[model samples]
Target: MRVFGMGSKAWLLNCAILFACPIAAQAAQDNGHGKNASHAAAGAHVHQISNHTTLASGAKVSHALHTASGKRVATRSFGISCVPYARQVSGIQVAGNAWQWWDNASGQYARGDRPETGSVLNFRANGHMHLGHVAVVTKVINSREVIVDHANWQSGGGVSHGVAVVDVSEANNWSAVRVELGREGTFGSVYPTYGFIYNRPDTGVVLASVSRPAPQPSINPVPSDLRPLAERPWRTMEEVAESPSTPRHTIDLGINAGVSR
Candidate 1:
């Protein structure tokens, strides 16, 4: 099995193609229908399309697709979770369970209680976070506070950007941290964490055990004008088509005329 790297543009392209193909196929079959029939079919198609969110590299991503009944369905995107996100940003490449990252890094990546840029902060599973969580350290504000970019923490449940993580541990260590949820400077739930995964000359870096295949480029490139689905709440197929960035094919997904992506 080939494991592809996360957060790359190639991955996004793959997602776009994955969503676009079925719509194209369905549109071909629906052609020649009358005006009212087309409208009904389109409405039915929108409902059939699945609207589910998935965790990729720890970031929440939506992979919406259409079904025959026009009822929306939700499916997980390519098994992407928090560990992959940490590996992608930190270049540590340690695999296995998210909670196991700390132990897995022994003799490979340096482990520490302090925060540093490019390090992976491993959160220990607690009552709230059952499987545990991992995030990348983007900036160190002071001894007590740091800024991080992580996936699956936002209320809408995608990627949370530039959030603050404050060390609330008693020993002044990073044993416990309160992460910023949505609002800037407002820390959310306090999660217990193992510590930070660092890459230093003394600690050494562990190469990934599994080799990931190069991502297959999408047959159609996402139009430059298209806005990322992650940026906003879920939108209907019609809304997506009406957006300025939506490709002609997306608009054609049972809507206007010919298909475009």
Candidate 2:
């Protein structure tokens, strides 16, 4: 949970690396292209669904593609961003798009404004936050405040654990909140949010249970005829020859048995 500003030195180093590595720049550009394509597909799907459904609150619903397990399919790496970070810690496989998490979670996960442990608080895109942000609730202090763990809140990319977030909205609905800056216990800027995404198991598409091979019985019953062989004591060459129940073969005399000539 170390928080530090992206100093000029680090910035210059990053610039130099980007300038020197053409492959890295190309890869970043390709990733952006893929993200754009995914967003376009999600937008088209949302548009198609919106034409048939009518909203009671008149609020525009966000939409994104989801996996069969009800988790969002991420096209890129889950680095120092609130979306994938929350998803990783919360055990919720949500998509890469942070702004559309609430709408994408509709009927799949429980949504509310109240803070709960393991729930993801989804923020809305605003002037300060263009892509929106998400954080996993770690502890609920009271009805007014809670602690969360998120990433990339500071200049240098890293997780901010146990950061206090308070409901500062006029309605006290948790629609707006001010998160603590680092471990300073001081509230930062106010940011608007959609709501909290609860980790509910009962809803959404039920995944088929994987049938495992039944464990083999530990006590293997040996046949009575083989019991003597299983329990027989070790026999020397002379012992084997003397035993009436055993057969003997001529031993090779060339092999030495620790006896000096």
Residues 177-226, candidate 1, lDDT per residue (tens digit)? 66543322233545667888886643454322132322221111121212
Model 2, 1-261: lDDT tens digits are: 133455766888998988979988899999999997886565333211111111233432222333464422222222486776887899877665888887888767878776788999888876556778888887775555666778776655556655566665545567666665422223455567887888985365422213332222111111111112332233434445666975555545676645543
lDDT of each: 0.56, 0.59
Model 1: lDDT to the true structure: 0.56
How far residue 211's Cα lies from its native spot in candidate 2, in Å, is 45
The top-ranked prediction according to lDDT is: 2
lDDT of 1 at 65: 31
* Model 2 bad stretches (over 4 Å): 1-79, 201-261
- Model 1: residues with Cα > 4 Å off, grouped in runs: 1-80, 154-157, 201-261
Q: Give the TM-score of candidate 1.
A: 0.46
Question: C-alpha displacement of 164 in model 2, angstroms?
Answer: 0.2
lDDT of 2 at 22: 99
Poorest lDDT segment (10 consecutive residues) of candidate 2: 218-227
